[model samples]
Target: MDKTLRRWAPLFVVPALICFIIAFLVPMIMGLVLSFFKFSTVTDGVFVGWSNYKRIFTDMDFISSLWMNVRFTIVTVFTINIFAFFLALLLTRGVKGTNVYRTIFFMPNLIGGIVLGWIWLLIINGILLPKGVTIISDPKYGFWGLVALANWQNIGYMMVIYIAGIQTINRDLIEAAQIDGANSWIRLKSVILPSVMPAITICTFLTLTSGFKIFDQNLALTAGNPARKTEMLALNIYNTFYTRTNFEGVGQAKAVLFTILVAVIALTQLAATRQKEVEA
Candidate 1:
């Protein structure tokens, strides 16, 4: 039976492998190739070498968008994880209606990003209208709006993961800490945190990547208004691709670079956090 199953495994895998190559691998390879060329279309592409890369760095909007995304990622990752962890801790306690509270918190994540963006747009505008400001009226407003939206959508999901992690911790370990003259703070710091380091690592990684790659929310919320001050790296690439008729190649180049940047950051974060998990 083992020999027969092993022989059939390659046949079962072949179709999925072919689909993967066609759906993802081919486009990815083509995108990489096209990044080095100047063209509005694949058929009309002209090999331009590093000029696209050069333009990406020289363009002030691209640089600004990149920095904005970095800032947003940093803020969102830290805030979301901290808030979620605390919420998870609270919910895991012997609180009434904890399941209902979890469901309520998580409902926002089930909403589509585009719908969420629009909903927040109206809600924020309603609040700011009284204050004589709007999300698109200024970059600062847009930035805060994005942060709020991200926190609302992601915190609950992260909380769920954290709750699972907290529950998995051995009850005796916590009891032992308590009996060892450890206060609540000490027990939390030395016992609970170390045991849940894996969950922290996972949550951090998810938030980092999601925050960096955010596009639909950025688009529907601000559309990079007020001279594109609120533009993020994803939106910048999109505008370069479709909005500017002559810069498709540059846009593709930006996308390729953005992909590389995200890959590097995510891998570094994972490696660092994984090391912490191992140590813990």
Candidate 2:
């Protein structure tokens, strides 16, 4: 049976491999090739070597957007995970109507990003109506607005993951901690947190990437106003690609760089988190 399954493994994997190559690998390779060439379209191409990449270095908007996303990622990752973990703890504690509360919290995650952004724009504007301004009126407002929107949408999802991790923890461990005179706080610190590292890892990765790659919310919420100040990296890349003419190669180059940046940051986060998990 094992030998037969092994023999058929290539057959089982071939379709997915072919699809991946055709859909992703081929396009990625083409995009990379295009990055080095100037083109109005794929067919009209002229090789420009490193000029497009050099332009990225002088692109202050790209730099600003990159920084904005970094700050946003830091704020959201911390806020979302910390809040979700506590919320998960509360819900896991034999609370009444846990399912209902979970549903209420999780509903925001179901909304599409564009829809979410509009909903939040209305809600936030209403809250700040007396201030005589809007989220788009100030970069700070836009920044915090994005953060709040992200937290509201994502907390419940992370909470669910945390709840699952919490549930999987051995009840015997809790009992032992209690018997050994460990208080609730101490037990939570020592046992609960360390045990839920997997959930932390998953939530951190999701929240971090989501924060970095946010485009629709940035578009609908502030549209990078009051003059592209609130634009995040994804939105910036988009503006470069579509809004600017004769910069397609430069835009493509930016995209390749963005991909590299995301890959590096994500891998670093995973390695750092897994190391801490092991140490814990």
Candidate 3:
């Protein structure tokens, strides 16, 4: 039976392996090769050495957008996780109508990114209009606007994960802590928090990646108006690829850099958090 299963497993896996190679691996290798040359299409690629990479550093728009995304990610990851953790704590306390509240909170996550952006845009602009400023009128406004939207979209989802973590905790440990005369704050720190670290790690990773790669919301909300101050890395790469002529190679180079940045940051985060995760 084992021999037969092993033989058939390869047959089943071969189709998926072929699809993976054709759909993902090929395009990735082609893009990397294209980044070293000047070409609008793969067939017409002309080698230009490192010129494409050099241009990216000197481009102010790209630098600004990259910087903006970093700042936004820092803000959103912190706020979203903090709020989600608190909400998770609140809902786990035998609160009335918790299921209803959970459903309501998670509803925003169901909205499409573009539609969510437009919804927030109208609401934000309506408030700022009375103050004689708009989300696009100032870089700070745009920055905070993105932060708020990220928190709104992600907090509920993170809360659900946190709730799961909290539920899985050993009640015996919590009871023992209480019997030892531990206060609410002490128990929260020594018991609940350490137990929930896995959930925290997952939520932080999701928010970090989402914040960096966000495009639809950025597009529908600000569209990088007021001279592209609010543009993010994804939008910048997109504009470089489609909006410019004879710069497809440079755009491809920017994409490779973006991939490297996200990979490094995510791996670092995982390493840092995994070291602190306690066994359940």
- Model 1 spans with C-alpha error above 4 angstroms: 1-11, 273-280
lDDT of residue 223 for candidate 2: 89
Task: Assess every candidate by TM-score.
Answer: 0.94, 0.91, 0.93
lDDT of 2 by residue, 1-280 (tens): 8887998988899999999999999989989999999998888989999999999999999899999999999999999999999999999888899999999988899989999899999998998899998887779998999999999999999999999999999999999999999999999999999899888888888988888889898898998998889899999999999999998999999999989988987898879887986887
> What's the lDDT for candidate 1?
0.91
lDDT tens digits, residue span 131-214, model 3: 998888888887888888888998899999999999999999999999999999999999999889888888989999999999
Candidate 2 stretches greater than 4 Å from native: 1-19, 269-280
Model 2: per-residue Cα lDDT at residue 87 = 95
The lowest-lDDT stretch of 10 consecutive residues in candidate 2 is 271-280
lDDT, candidate 1, at 155: 94
Model 3 lDDT on a 0 to 1 scale: 0.92
